[model samples]
Target: MTHETRSSRRNFLAASSGLVAAAAMPPALAQTAPFLITSATDVLLPKGKAQRVVICGGGWGGLNAAKQLRQLAPQLEVVVLERNPVFFSCPMSNKWLVGQVDTNFLTFDYLKVSEKYGYRFIQTEILAVERDRKRVVTAAGSLDYDYLILSPGIRYNYEAWFGNDRRAAEATRARFPAAYVPNAEHFRLKQAIEDFKGGEIVMTLPPPPQRCPPSPYERACLLAWHLKTKKIKGHITILDHKDGIRPIGLGFRQAFEELYKDQITYVPNAQVKEVDPFNQRIKTAAGDFKFDHAILMAPHQAGDLAWKAGVIGKNAEGKPTGWSGVDPLFLNLRDDRDVYVIGDAVGIVSPQFLFYPKAGHVANRHAKIVARYIAERAAGREPAYSLPDNLCYMWVSADPQQAINVQFDYKIGDFQDKGKVILQTQIDDNERRPELIVEDFRWFGYMREDLFG
Candidate 1:
């Protein structure tokens, strides 16, 4: 089939209501088989002639983008570069920490994901992004790409908390496991919690723009639940840098007040001034607090690759912003159309209208949008970009199996001249429900299948 005819056929199939409905079916049905890519266009590359796409980071965003790209345009050559061989999801990992789920359930094989989607998977650390040459340099070798999607994720900003003492910062991180990222830290935190005989367990929430806005609160709640169930004589203390646990502030506040009032103590605006890992204490603006166990959610910034690429630059006051600048419409770098930034790495455009929570659900939705845009561009068409949405669920307790849900919607303004972006947010009723917990698992299952099945 001619390229145009092939594109038309694929578009028709994608738009079919039946196919759309099938795509929305539960994960149990969809996971039974590989998602069929029904493009008649054969993978007829004439000696390295296909457009090459490189996806950096194999998290929810990059993996989903690769899968969607292959589903939309299988003829194109796609590659995924991930630092780690195994993909451990940050979403719902708190459950693993609280003993709700096993660690194996949070991990997946990158090789399987790549094989299932027919993409080259390379486990290598990215050294640099050669934007002018449209190539990425890894520890192993340099890779050229026609298009690059960066979902490099976030890196903890230790300097912000520890100042000039790099060694002290590293020591602090080692001593207190954040467990925000999917790593050995989760197990460390779990062990610490388990070993705690009594006294206080202090968990600090960093300032805004952290991944999974509601996660720290969720962790606090679940940990309190664990302690309560175990009859451990311990009080869980939450120190928040912000005014309160936000995005789902009201809901979380109510949860703390009603359920774990005796076991949980929440102190807001408790910014960290210094951390004494040796003494097992944190000096914050609110006050100096000592703990038998601690999990410090340190400040976070865009991945180091972004800073190395010069995409993350100083602001007007000559302070590092620690995020990549991308076009609000396409998530493409302002200076380089060939490069796109998504997920937590994307800099805030406008906090009022364009800001999105740094969450896995947001990243998954971003992957779809970027993948569709790239597919349309490859087909020589102006794509109809879809408005990205974010859906997040936070569990409140384990025994009762209750959770809270939040959704965010965005749209461009009606006036073409103004080009203002608009945002709308909704939180499910403050009352947590067992059904929401079931739906949370269903949501996670669908997301997993969408990216790796």
Candidate 2:
């Protein structure tokens, strides 16, 4: 097919109704499965009024579960707790930031979702989770539930690395903001690019156990492409914490050599010790350096709520770790009897890398399992939880027509292995799969719609 024809086809695949078809397909075909490993039969489904599911965070996991619960169990009451009224999608958003896609399309309103899904939307932050009482206390009110799903997502640890350099954050917010959180920072970052005359533009990668692991490199590459194409001068520096690169490090190397070339510089094992916003200098393990603009993607965690609730695993000294334990289906680690945890807030990593990176796709898939389980329980039946297969796609627009993907599956309790099966597809420099593009569009759209549509 012609390029235009192929683009059209992919767009069609990504349209609203296309999600049902895409979701029905196996991960190999969809190239977008999250945590689809081994399937679990209906063994531990809960029954009747015994299940009151209160999902926290209106992001992918909680929102997806809320939608599924309403669809599968119409009589069961579901409440979604989200601090934001609209969700600004992180996937495909980079395209928008680079002026490829419009910014408006990336924004989805939860009010529409509240109307369609018939679920309660409490715009409040969760202060604490009383698991013993089966209750959650928020800034707005206290909610009681039989089952709880926490998907509050990852929180950046600025104090650990930044120290007294709080101004570094402000400087970043004033310069190349880390739009990873999707708000004013996102737009501000875009504007910084628009205003840049181009000097040393630096982007740092966070340590592991952070959200969207591959995203930093993707962002750096895309930004470099934009700078090169726009003929902006100066070096595009990527400072990483580890001695090596990221998850699909080899593939990324291929991508870097083929695409970014000398436009981007790689600094390995160069951890940023501290950043001086006053002088715009970043002190790293290697040494100190100054930049015209910088973005520090810091290490992240599950935040204070998990610690206050005594849910997240504690260290030998009883300090809170990043996340709580979760099963294959993302149920709570402490008491899988009735709770579910999803997204970066979850601690269980599939040995098969099925649910790696904690991306939006993985969160959505976990939502389906949690919702299905909740629905089954409401009907006085046992709910089964299954593993999710994940297909992660990276769009490097230097060669805008193509995309690269990594696919994997997970088995419960096998988070350390890559399972026996791993699937991957590289769309090549010029090859275009309409279905893949369609899957991308549909994936983000459905994710937005299903969550905050």
Candidate 3:
């Protein structure tokens, strides 16, 4: 991000500043299961007389969109359909895993946020979207919608690693759980980390454009830190699928060499060829390896809801891109004004947004920008377009409380670029600084307070 871009981003963040508050973690409102109402539905789902907007997914994107819509158009009934009753923060979860933060720090109640912001939230599985009939077919029932915003986030594409072997994929998911998906996965991974009476913990990274580009490396650093501090008889091996530490390479590389050289092994471009999860072994392009424990991050795709919604786009070769076909700038379906896909599930073919990193900060900004467009269109006004800017933070050490930061700013391209956005990145040497972590806390805390406080 340039100086000007950074200032603008700061202003936007400052605008959302509210009294920081974290809701008390609640027990499961009902039995935690699929296709079931986890929250109390005895009161009945809100049947608003006005135009209804259903925001799918209760994570960062959907929740922010709900908040904005209620404020922008109070007459519009905003309903968010999410599978989980409690909201979990994937952003700060690495901190949680290493005991720097508690589970309470990562969990928030959806009902409390819904009530506080005057939006309706239903904890029911979203089966599919009936776009032609203008309704959502869910476990609860068919829900008619005036407008639908899909923001269900990312899901692992296990097929990339496991091929057609369902059992292998499931076994890998069960044994070497990747914690990127939130809540349960995080719990499983955390337990695995704690239980490691270890020799070598193997960690793998998925290819680019996945949610939070820095997550795997960050976790590796934290895991190494944990082993170093706890005097655990182990080291970490990062089987990176990419060429190198991306976006903020120098920072991570410096840390790897200076701080964790004795405890971490960095391997680049280790394209996974085959997996033998049952035998606790994997074959990658570089070599074959067996592990005492493994954290396997499979390739990513749009969440199931996006596929079920029939919004996923196809490439020029007719292969499914595993992301929604939506207007690059406005985030609305080009063919259907009534449908929009936000967050990590959204994709574009243009040069600017193609392979845009599916991170939460961008999703939050993207949702709000789309909310304005939706509100303006609802008022029968022509909507304007704007690009998004974001910041990503990673913790390389818990002991010194130091971290690395990367900022991205974007602007509408010139005449030759055909209205697409151009990226401006600002990460000089990617130094690990203590202040960066503080800003990270504020970023997470402010977002929590803005919607739930």
- Judge candidate 2 at residue 77 and give its lDDT: 62
Candidate 2 local lDDT, 45-83, one digit each (tens): 122242457888877677788888878876666678787
- Which ranges of candidate 3 are over 4 A from the true structure? 1-48, 415-429
Q: How far out, in Å, is residue 30 in model 2?
A: 39
Per-residue C-alpha lDDT of model 3 across residues 173-202, encoded as one tens digit per residue: 888998889778889888988888878778
User: Model 2, clash count?
Assistant: 16
TM-score of each: 0.87, 0.79, 0.88
Instruction: Report the poorest 10 consecutive residues by lDDT, candidate 1.
Output: 38-47
Per-residue alpha-carbon lDDT of candidate 1 for residues 354-453, written as tens digits (9 for 90 to 100): 4578888889989999999999999999887676788888999999899887887776664445556654555555678899899999999999898777
Q: Which of candidates 1 and 2 reaches a greater TM-score?
A: 1
| lDDT of all predictions | 0.80, 0.67, 0.80
Q: Local error of candidate 3 at 311, Å?
A: 0.7
